[model samples]
Structure formats: structure tokens, C-alpha cells
Target: MEAEKKVIIVRFSGELSIKPDAEKYQAIERLCKQISLRLSEKNVFIDITHFHDRFQIKVSEQEVQSVCAVLDRSFGVGNYSLVDFQCSSKEEQILRLVPNYQDQFSGAEFRVRVKRSGQHSYSSMDLEKKAGAILGKTAKVNLSFPQKVLHIEVINEEAFLYSEKRKGPGGLPPHKRERALVLMSGGFDSAVAAWMLMKRGVCVDYLFCNMGGKSTERQTLQIAKVLSDLWNPDPIAKFISLDFTDSIEDIKKHSSLTYRQILLKCKMYEAASNVSKILGCYAIVTGEALGQVSSQSLQNLRAIDLSTRVSVLRPCIGMDKQEIIKKAYEIGTGVLSAKVLELCGITQGKAVRKANPSKTDEYLQSLDQSLIEKAIQERTEILLKDVDGKMLQSEYLFVDEISEGYEVIDCRTQKEFSQWHYAGARNLSLRELLANLKSLNKKKKYVLYCSFGTQTPVAAEIMQQSGFQAYAFKGGIGKLRSLQK
Candidate 1:
């Protein structure tokens, strides 16, 4: 006998349902397109039915759960159910299907809920009472607060049955909203901010200020690629990268340390505004949480943003750090954010908590405006999908290939280096490399390694970009040890 086919019932958020008829229709259409594209990528063929209240997706039982997981993470999905069995809508057939689910309500309180669509000889209440009659004997029926609830949907000639539903990320689909540029930092907060906007139906473009070095650019590009692939997946999304090293250097020379951070932020806004105007973005979004850092205070934000006419949106402003992190992990960017090489060298020492607008203005005026304009003019635009594949593959060298005058720096934590590292390798934790990048001798050749070699590319790229010859040790310390054995 052939196995029973399964289907997923997906429901849009209450917000989408309450929109005007035209708006609701458009939202549903966009959501359906996204769902179809995502499902097609998984090689899953499904029949989608858009009912008045929900979307019914029919697929094989084996792929039903996988399909549901994809829909669960997508925007505009309020909740979803997995329907495994379908039968004739007639009262006799539904009654027979009820007993098969009796094991689920075993020794637990259960409830029967029914919804009807097409003309049926029996009302929903009639079908419910019949299913309840057989269920009451095996399990206690608590209509108010049941541990398990069996849902039945009678649509035209068929009735669908399901017991559980999963919660979905409830928001309007992306591409329905206006386009905006996100000041992506590839960190925990910024990526989450971009996600929040995407979840709320905003089509986002990324604007990255490459202040840290090539490593920062590479890491930011990867994070942006992940965001583009998962949430939006639209090929038209642009990843705008600006080399802001000259801008940062100019700030260091002309601006005071107390207001340097705020001044640098202003320059970013100025550049973002220029870029946004060129790209036709409606606004600029950031991951800045209010008062999370010295530079994010309301005063500092106000002072830095004093010059831009482009609207700046901070979605994570009111949210706490832990809340933002929790969302990042939920959306699958937490691991990348955690592993990203952080550049703590931006600040000189204690930064101004609340920057005075007058002083900030003075500092901004002191710097050559041409610096920011030049960076924006030289901005490179690439499709988000192509950024990752375009990274210059780092060369890898084996232990035997280590020649004279080559410096081997272990890109691991200090504790890991202390535990056991290769002979003559200096500990330069990924965090420390960014902090003291300028001090490294640019003329010298360097060999970078990490546990299993996953992190060497980041350090090697940073070194290579800083005008030094760098190679990642193939297989890291693990490969070297194995070679010795």
C-alpha cells in the first residue's frame, strides 16, 4: 500500500491579514513567491493553495517537516501546521480517522477543534462531537486547557487532520518594503539590525566601511552574503564596500581623541548619505543600540548625525545587547559574528561618552571633506551573491615550506597558545592582531596559523593587505603535528 501523503498549512501574521484587501493580496503574492523560490532550492515539489485564511502546501511526507522548517524561519508566517492524513469530508470518514490519533491523547487532556470550508452535510460542531465521543473514552477532554489539541479542516471534498503547529517569524515579507542601505559592521549588533529590517519587509542594501583592513572586509562580506541568501535571497541586492582607511587616518590627525569616535561616525553618515542618494535608498539603517557603547549615546548620535539629510533608522536602538544577540542566534548569524575578528583599535583611549555638538562640528570641519567624498566616489559595488566567491584565495604553506626570515604567528587565544603551540610561533590572538596592526613590520614575510586552519585566512588576508607577504600554514598546527608523526 502507498503511504499517506502530508501537507503543511501556513498562516500569515495577523498584521498582514488586517491590511486593506489590495495590500493583503499583494503581501500574500510576495510571500508566495518567496516560499516557492525557497522550496525550489531544496528540490521539493509542492502544490500551493492560497485559501482565504491560510496557505495549504502539499508535499511528500518525508519532506513535509523540512519544508515546514524553511517556512517557519521565513517572514510573514504567523504559524504553521503539518497535516498528515486527508480523507473524504463526509462525517463517517472523519470519525474513522479520529481513533487513529487516540494514542496521542493517551492519559492527557485533549480538545477537538474543527473548521469547515465548502458545503458539507454536517456542521463543524457535528464532526467535532463525533470525534470527541470516541476520544472521551481514552482521554480526558478539557476544552479550556487541553494538553493536546486535534485540529480538523474540512475543505470541499477533503478533510485534513493535524495535531501540532509551530510558531513562525511573524512579519511582512521582504521586497514589499522600500529599499534602504544598512551600515553593516559584520558584528553581533549590526547584522541583527539588518535582519530586523529585512524581517519587517525592508529590502536592504549593505554599506560597509572597511576601517579594520581586508580581514574586516572579507568577514563583513561573508556575513552580508549569509544575510542576502537566507532572508532576502534577491540577486539584485548590492554590497557597497568603501575603503575608509584614509578617512580614519585623516580623523586621527585632525580630530581630538575625545571626539574622534563621534567624528568618524559622522564621516560614515556623510558617506552613507551620499551613497544612499546615488542608490535611491529611502533611508540608512544601523545596528546601533542606544547607549550600548560610548559612541552610541543619544548625544553622540545626535552630534554625529547633525549634518545628514538622509533618514537614519536604528532598529536595535531600544533593544538590549542580550536581546539582540538572542535574535542574531535565532536568525543564524551569531556564529559568524562571534568568530569575526574585532577591531578594538578604533579608539585611542577613553572615548567621549556624550560628545558636545559644537566640538563635534569643529572636529568635522577641521578634516578635509574631500576625504569622505573621495572614499564614497571610489566605492565599489558588487552583487551580494558574488562577494564571497570573489575573495582572493589565500596561499597555504606546509611545515617544511617554512623558510628563513618567515614569522609564524598563531592566530589562537592566549590560553590555547600557552597550552601547546608549535616551536618559535608567537601568540597573536585574532583580537590582538587588529589592535596592533600598524606596529607589525610590513617588510617582513609572515606565516599565520590557527587550530585546524579555519581562522588563518582572516589573519593572512589582513597581513597581506597591510603590505606584507603572508601565507597560512596548511592544516594549522594539527597538520604540522601529524607530519612529524
Candidate 2:
């Protein structure tokens, strides 16, 4: 009464040369075991252990195909293959059936295609010869146009003969590495940039520079945390706090304020390089929109980065603000930290009249000792969490910008809010937001949210115009769930 079960065999290639750690192999084995467990095939089996039995560690012809499929797109893997495919035995094979009818097949000539397992006994040429001889004796041999050609395969102790062949996963797999530093600010562009990199499996490490000088505001930290929560619920990616306050001041003192905006970035890049070296990272990442701001200009990014030797990776380099924000919302970081991200205006207010080398140096020198020490201390002993509430994505939680107080309100969906919203939050769907708006006291600065942040902006705008200082959640509820998960 039960249906037949199907199986996919596997093998490893170049695995010996790579010499992956036991954990890696174990991970792969576990993935395989999980697959086997999920399927109800009685014949499902895998035997990578055979690699130890081979003289050259070569995969059998039967195992090469399936191994490749499973290994495809698997990062940190050297090579793999779908090796052995167990099928009906030679006696039960269809090729043998064709030979019996060779006499009846007169017009069309068919050739048996033999792909003997490399380690198995028979050879393709030999099988082909044997099949031809058998068919020749049975009927007029039309080897060139054989109408009943069959496929035959043998590996280990099993043999498969059929009229059709199972194809393998063709083409190279996508290559991805799970580590990159993303320059995250409480802005949509950078947030989206980081999200895109994360999607590519690049384990994101956030370098939040207080280039605008509002790092002291707690809002910055909140925004960073929201973004952090969305990408890594339990927080896998490290958020590295970078103090550009002093550097920005230094640039302003040494150069023209107009240029301060650009050179300030150079110093920030220099600082990022130092931080990256400390964190065992190299690439400097950001969410710079091409031509969006003076500092984002190719000339400016190149000018500023000239201070460092490390390569800069702008994942959202060519993207527009709307595109970046769209991605940020999709990734669930857009509105969670809405309140925190709004502090950027204050940081920008700190940029000076002149930001040249000498003045820049002075400002750097003048940085409050307490602030510098505190910032470093916080970053050194930071804790990171991912969306799943696991304490993994990162061990580092850079200082999110410091901020004053305002009641934090989350407007994300109930499910999202329950996963992780502020300790005190009101569940208000976007549809019911208008009715709830009437209930909110005008005196309170209303910050709104959606599940991952979709409706807060509209609500905030409406409330702000109605004489309330309304702020939206930057990273939204999705980010909160990521903390310590």
C-alpha cells in the first residue's frame, strides 16, 4: 500500500586536499542525516566513509551526480559530488529487454550507452561491444541507427540498466563568503546595504561611525541595535562603535567646513581601518548612495579612503535612497530603531566651519577623555544577538548612539511585537492606527512601528503634523527579537 521511496547518493571531491575540520564534516554529515530523516525512503543512504577505502579518494561514477547537488551553494565547502545512483540491477535492466527484441527492430539502429562505475568491474567500451554482439546475433545489426539504445551503469555491488538517464546538477554553484564589515548608521541606505550583504551570506559586522557627532545620543545605539536585531536576531554580527566625533571636529578645525564633510569621512575611514585590523577584518563596508551626498561622491569616497589601505566595499553604491530603504524595510530593520535613527540631525549639527588636518588633529586631541575611554570600553566588551534570540551572530555589540528619553512605542504586528517589542508597547495595527491616534496624548512624542516596520512613518508624519513630536521605530520589532536570541 506504501509508495516507493527515492534516494540521492553523495560523494566528496577535493575534500581530502581541503582537509576540513571534523566540525565541517560533521556539519555536512548532519545535514545529510537530517535530509535522510526528513524523507521516508527505506533505501535512502549515504556513504562518504568510502573516501577512506579508495586508493586515490576518487568518487565512483554512480556517486558523483548527487554529491554535487547537495554541495552546491554550500559555503566553506571545498568540493562535492553526487556519485553513486543505485538503480534496478542488470537482470532487471531494460537494455537486456531490448536485446531480446533485436530481431523485431529492423529499421532504426540504437546503441547502448554504457557508463560503468569507475571502480566497478566493467568498462563502457566493453559493455558497448558486448551489447552489440548480443544484438547482432539476435537480428540484423544496425549499430549506427539503433532505435532501442539503453543506458547501463554499475557501481559497488549494484547495477542499473534503463532506457533513460538521470541528469546531474550542471553549472557552477554560487560562491558566497559569510564575513564583511558594514558601515551601519541609523539611515535607510546603510541599513539596506548591510541587509543586501547579509543576504549574500556575508556575516555582517557593523561599523557605526558617529560622523555626524550624535554618537552621544542614546538614539544612535537604539537604531543600531534595531538594525542588528533584524539581521541577526540573537545578534551574530558584531557592531563596532567608531567615534568620529573627535575626528569630525579635527577635520573642521583643519579644513573648510564644506570640505569638513568630506575629509571627516577620510578620518572615519582611517579609524575604520584601525578597528578592522583589531577585529581581524579587512574590507570596509558602507551604504553610500552614489552621488547622494558630497561624501558619497566617487571623488570624495576615494579622497577620504585614501587615508587607509584597506579595500572599501559599498554594497549599495549604485542604489538610490528609495531602493535602499525598500530593502531595509524588507529585511525588517527599517522602523525598529526609528526613534534612535532620528538623532542624525543632531550629529550633523556638530560639523564645524573648518575641518582641515591641523584643526582635525586638535579636535581629536580635545576629545573628552571620558567619552573616548567609555566608547572603547563599550565596544571592547560588547554583546551581540541575532533575530533568533541566540547569542551568536556576534559577540560584539558596539555602543549604539547614546540618547535622551522618550516613550518608545512599537506599532509592528502583534506576532512581531510579542517576539520582541519594547517592555511597554501598545498593539495597534495600521488599519486601527487612526482610532488609536485619537487616544494618544498630544504631549507625548509618539514613536510608531509595524511588524518589521512598514506603517510607522505614515503614523509618525500624521502625529507630528498634528502638533506631536512623533518618531518611528528604526529597526522595528524584528530587530528586538534578534537580541540575545
Candidate 3:
């Protein structure tokens, strides 16, 4: 029998802080479960050394390894090394490891970069020479770009040696105890806000409300599902969810294209406050950038604030679109988020308008208060998915379109489907998928998903070959779960 290979997963390149710790630690747990469901391998290991500044939970040895191994394959890790690790002091890190790196690549053309977490004994020039001396004079490598590169980390207490550049969910790590409700629009801004907060360790729950319009209705909720799927692939994400759709829609029923944006937002905050009260969340989060849109104006923002009692957090408020995209890239959610098709993208007015607080208030008052309450009572719901197609636990504002025509299917386990599933996708497991397959309507649209994207493909492929039109959720249950606010 082949020996089980042991691989190490390391996290690097993120600024750590104490913001989303609760949500972050929960994410770690969720990630572990997602990994376990993926592969049968038993020798994976993960070291969250880069989370030095954050308060991460200490998982068991087996659990850590399991999470590490799964993420390596699913999320595209930089280096999954099969080697022994020696954690020693700083001086030892330099003297012992430097020579070892040289011996490994005797003639390979390469460059060495030394990064210090604190002051070190060797000068910058001295370290390069040391690396060069260790390698020998025969090696010809460009410092700017080399075939092989060595990364040396000199920390305050110790050092680490790795042959690869690892990537991390960069941003401030999630801090425990801090809570924020995200204003999740199915657009770039809100999605980026949630990402920023997740990086800093803030446990962010979502409050996505869509105003009633002639455009594709449930499409916004579907978009939220995509983002939720990408972020919380772990089937355990109760971290995010939907409020009510009807409540917000009611506001729009009594309003129009004029100040509808302002009034609708105010009502959303009100319903969000109710959601906050129920979920024990503290503040609200949004994807607000300075001067980005009419509703984002400082005056209009203040008017919207009048609807809620909690503090509001705008993670993207100070960031530009480019900056937000860069962060998204670092977190690996860029490609998935990029694929989303939001209905609201084309509706914005070209002329920039600063909000008038007084006018915004007037707009809010113009809507029927009775209609607002009714909209709150009739909330819509949805599920989010991740890059790998795991559905995040989510709740979204209800749109009438869900029950209208489309056929939704839950490809999760029987128990999972029983516990909860999308509104239309009756409970069905992959094992029993084909048996019940004949019942599906061939003419209608369909969706398939597993807990994360594991089993959906099997069902999707079967349906497609069987002459039924089908779509496999890129991310599965974890994404869907994030939609339940």
C-alpha cells in the first residue's frame, strides 16, 4: 500500500486585526467541515501563522489537517508541501535554514527574498550575500525574476522557510464580539463590503432588500446566493441571511423612480433593525463608496440612517472600485464575483447627485407607513454559493418570482433537505437523484447543488444527458444558506 502523504497548508499575506473574530473563527469551522466533505485523505495539515494578530480557535490536529488538505485542492493554495517543519529561534532560522535552502538547489537559477517581522541581526545586504555564498558562485539567477524563489520570514521570535508564496484571505481578520449586518445589494459594492469585513474578523450577517421593479425580480437574490456561496463554502454559515423582501417591496408600491431610492433604503434599515434584534447582531454593514451613487451621498446616507438604531459600517466607504477589486483578487473571490450578472447595473443615473437630507426625509415620509410594515411581514428568502459551488446558509428578501415558474432542486443529503432546502427544490440526495429524476419537468428550468459543489455535478450531468435542461450551482448549500437573512 502507498504511504499516505502528509501536506502542510500555510496562510500568509493578510493584515490581521480583531474585528471579525467570531465570524472568522466560525468561518474556520465552516471551512473545516467543507473540507471534510470533499476528500477521504487523512494527512492534511494547516498552520494559521499569518493570523498572528487575530484570535483564531485552536482546532485539533486531525481537524486542522483536514481543513488544510481540502482547501489546497478546492481553493487553489500556493504551496502544499510534504516536509518536516522545525520551529526555532530567529538566529537559528537564519543560520540553520539559509544553508539548507542552498543545499536543496545547488545549481538551480533562483533569487532569495528575506522578509522580517522585526529587526534582524543580518543587514539587508548581508543576508543576500549569505544566501549567495550558500548557493555558490556557479548559480546564475536574476534577482528581479528567477526560475526558483526562496522566501524567508524573520519574525520577532523565530523564522520560517518556504519555497512558495502563500496566499491568504487578506483584509483585516474577523474579530469576535463585534457584529455587523451587511446591506447586501446584488452589485459590486455590497459584495466588496462583506469581503472587507470578513477579512478584518467581523462576523457579518446580511440584510439584502430589493425594491419592487419591472426588472428581473428574484435575480437579485440569486446574485446574493452567488456571493454567499463564494465566501462561506462551509455548510455551517449561519453567519449571513436575508431579511424580508415584501417589506421593502411594499415601500416601492407606494413610491416611484423619483425618491424611491431614499425611502426604500430607510425602510430597509427599519426591517434590518428587526432582523438585528432577532439575530442579536449589533451594527449594519454596507458597500458604500464615497460619491459612488445618488443614494450613497452623505446627506442621503444620514436620512437612511434615521430608520435604524444600530451603528452602520461601510467597509468600502473609503475604497475605490479598483481597490475593492484588488482585495477581492487577494481573497480569491474575484473570479466568482466577476461572473455575477446583476440587474441593477444599468439603471443608475449618469449625473452625480449629492443627497439632500431634508429631501430624503420628505421622500421617506411620502411612502405609506402601512405599506412599509406589510413589506416587512412579507420577506423573501434565498441561498448563497461559493466558488467551488458550496451553498452558504443565507436568507434573502422574498420575491414573487421564486414561486412563479422555475424549478429549484436541493442536491443536498436527505437530512439536509429535510432540515431546510430552497423553496422549490424538494429534498433529494445524489444517491436517490436518478430514481426521482423522471419526475422533473423537462420543459422547466432547473438548479442542482450539494453542500458545497461536491455532488451537484453528478446530478447535473445526469440531467443534461437525459435531455433535461439543468444548471449546477457553482457553489452549493453554504451559498444558499447565506441568503436566509
lDDT by candidate, in order shown: 0.79, 0.49, 0.54
Instruction: Encode model 1's per-residue lDDT on 1-485: one tens digit a residue.
Output: 86656778899998999999988989899998888888786567788899987898878776665476568668999999878578888888888888888887888999999999889898988888889889998999898999999999989998888998878889988773488999988889889989888888988899998878877777787778767766677767888889888988898999777777788788889989999888879999989999888998888888877968999999999999999988876665665687677553378789998888888888888898898788888887888755433252444422335677888888765645665666788998666675687888888888777654544565566567777778777655546655545
Best by TM-score: 1
Q: What's the alpha carbon RMSD for model 1? A: 10.3
lDDT of 3 at 315: 77
- TM-score: model 1 vs. ground truth: 0.79
lDDT per residue as tens, model 2, 142-259: 5577566555555555554444322322221112233566666667776677656544435556677664454332334444555544333323456666555554454445554455
Per-candidate TM-scores read 0.79, 0.45, 0.56
Off by over 4 Å in 1: 1-5, 387-485
How well is each residue in 1-485 modelled by candidate 3, as lDDT tens digits? 64333334344223222327774455544433434445432333333333443212233443443343244333312233322333454554565666666666667888877666566666656666676666665566678778777665555665556676434444332334656677666566776787666555466566655543413233334334434444433232233333335544554566445566666667767767776776677888877787777777787787778778888888788888888877654433443345345433322344225556676666666666665455545554333322232232111211112334657777544544665567657766554566777877899877666555543544565577788876666544545655543
In model 3, which regions exceed 4 Å deviation? 1-134, 140-161, 172-176, 211-257, 322-352, 380-451, 454-485
lDDT of 1 at 378: 86
lDDT for 358 in candidate 1 is: 85
Q: Rank the candidates by lDDT, best first.
A: 1, 3, 2
Steric clash count of candidate 2: 81
**Alpha-carbon error at 408 in model 3, in Å?**
24
Question: Which candidate model has the greater lDDT, 2 or 3?
Answer: 3
